[model samples]
Target: MKDIQTHDRQRLAEKLRFLEPDVIEVITTNFCQQHPETKEPGEVDTTHCITDARYHLTFLRTAIEFGTEETFRQYLRWTTKVLQTRNIPHHVLQRFLEEIFHALEPHLTDSEKLVVRTHFLDVPESGLTERQTPARSESPLALHQEVFLQALLAGDRHAARTIALEALSSTHSLSDVYVEVFQESLYKIGSLWESNRISVAQEHVATAITQYVMANLYTCVTPSQPSKGKGIITGVEGELHQIGSHMVADMLEMQGWDIRFLGVNIPHQAILQLIKEFQPTLVGISATMVLKVPIVRDLIKDIRNHFPSAATPRILVGGSAFRALPDVYRDIGADAFAYDLRTLTTLLS
Candidate 1:
């Protein structure tokens, strides 16, 4: 029964994807006609409405593909807070969601419409209260993490690098810096962006600073022993979040693995060609967005098809996607899913 619902949702998502442009147009037109106040200068204009409609549909499609409303619900909750922070009235958000549902109605079957309506039934109410600071981690390097995060938020690359290097020089190991500082800080930055506590530009700046800091710290990471095995780490296609993958590659290299870190959004053919040339012992794929899990699954399938069972590299998956659905890797035929660097190294060992 569950599998049948999942299939229906998948089909619905695919259909919506095909009709995205038309659906978005209908949503924008209806929203404008229903709310003329939004068309005023400096208000939510047609362009903004179109963009929001696209994102709304995209998030809904992802939720359907996941076979759970939790994904869409979470996005709606975050968006509600963000809109409230921007002084956009709560009613406008509600109206936008309603417009989306009506726009999609013409394209969906009665059953599919019911599934979509379920996703919209419990819209989150907006709150005007200020977002509280995220709680501090209990890690010993918590202080360093806090300082590093503030530095990144402030766009002080030098301070961020110095904090990371200083922590590495102290009693803290490279793993501590990566996990307790970099990973934790990035997570907090994501939360801030979702809550509208910080702008997207600020979040990008923080990520860039962290990447810079990681590069500087790489100079200090020397393997103490011979190579354990060859490995390739990359983000799945269309996945722009590569910092976590980069950290995994660096840690693996430090563990005496021959690591090749291919950047994000790599093509399937490119990955296969690399596998043929490199013949790695392990291939680590990262997909930060839950929506990209299907792409990861397909990539894994391609790898299996192109290589004999005995020749295929041990496929390991990770990132934020698997954090919520830890067993999904097994479902996708991946050999393993690592939540963090320690788990990954432990699995390899």
Candidate 2:
């Protein structure tokens, strides 16, 4: 039975490679037909059509390469997000998944058939059943962004901690403050620096203050229970942005994962050594700049080559770099790419 399963998995991979172009065409055609609004009259290219086709193609490639329950779920969840962004109805997204299944049916072996049947075919059609995407109202912490920013700018770590603690003391989840308060504030700071409204030194000072504030809140978030699993979060070599990765580390730590956070610009040797020593269940690497992307890709390549198949950790990639470049994570060999803490939580959940 194991041998049969292995053969079927390999067979599916091969078929996916050979049939990709055809599969993409099928998916794109179905998507266009289902949502005629996606097609613009007398236009050589439409945003929806291009994005839809690329999304399906990337999904197929990533799904085939990873072929795990977690990866499959990421694909589905990402599809739902894409559909929601386009303001397309949830039901249309449901039909899209169904079309992908139909498009690949002929290529699936009996064993593969059962795999997709359970994971894809019979999976919850939540997108189809739901009338619309659930509304995500503004976070209450967002209302205090000005206060947080002011404190950080003033280099008042005390004031920042007070604000964060007050939010955490409220009904808000730790995850909420991490996203709205820290992430969004840093984003605003960066924008200010970019527009010359704030100096580079000011940006650095604000970020340092915010990091200090995050440190102070750690005691509040530290889990009492045993760890769920081990996790390693870091910025790839040549990547200087550690705050984003640090936020992820905190989130995982709060969730009771024995997490090792290797701060900015860690070498491949150190990372590989730690992974082998720690044998973590998950590894998250971040690259804030586009130039650092190649470092991430190389890191993944080395990890795959050095580690035995079973011992390999589930790799996740994130950062502003991937946020700007859509679907690049699929090509970079990471199991999943999270655009932010919210998506990261969803991916892990």
Off by over 4 Å in 2: 1-137
Computed on alpha carbons, the lDDT of every model, listed in order, comes to: 0.83, 0.74
Q: What TM-score does model 1 achieve against the real structure? A: 0.88
Best by lDDT: 1
Where does model 1 exceed 4 Å of error?
Answer: 1-5, 32-44, 119-137
- TM-score against truth, every candidate: 0.88, 0.61
lDDT of 1 at 333: 85
Instruction: Give the top-scoring candidate (TM-score).
Output: 1
lDDT by residue (tens digit), candidate 1, 1-349: 1354656767888998998998877876678666654453576457766777788888778667766565566667666776665667777877787777888788788988887786554464533233465975498888999999999889999999999999999977898899999999999999799777898899999999999999999998776464698999998779998999999998988888898899999999999999999999899999987778889999999999999999999999999888856767886889999999889979988
Query: Residues 52-169, candidate 2, lDDT per residue (tens digit)?
Result: 6656545444344434444445555655554554456566656666777788788876767676666544556662332444866776777677789888778788888899989888
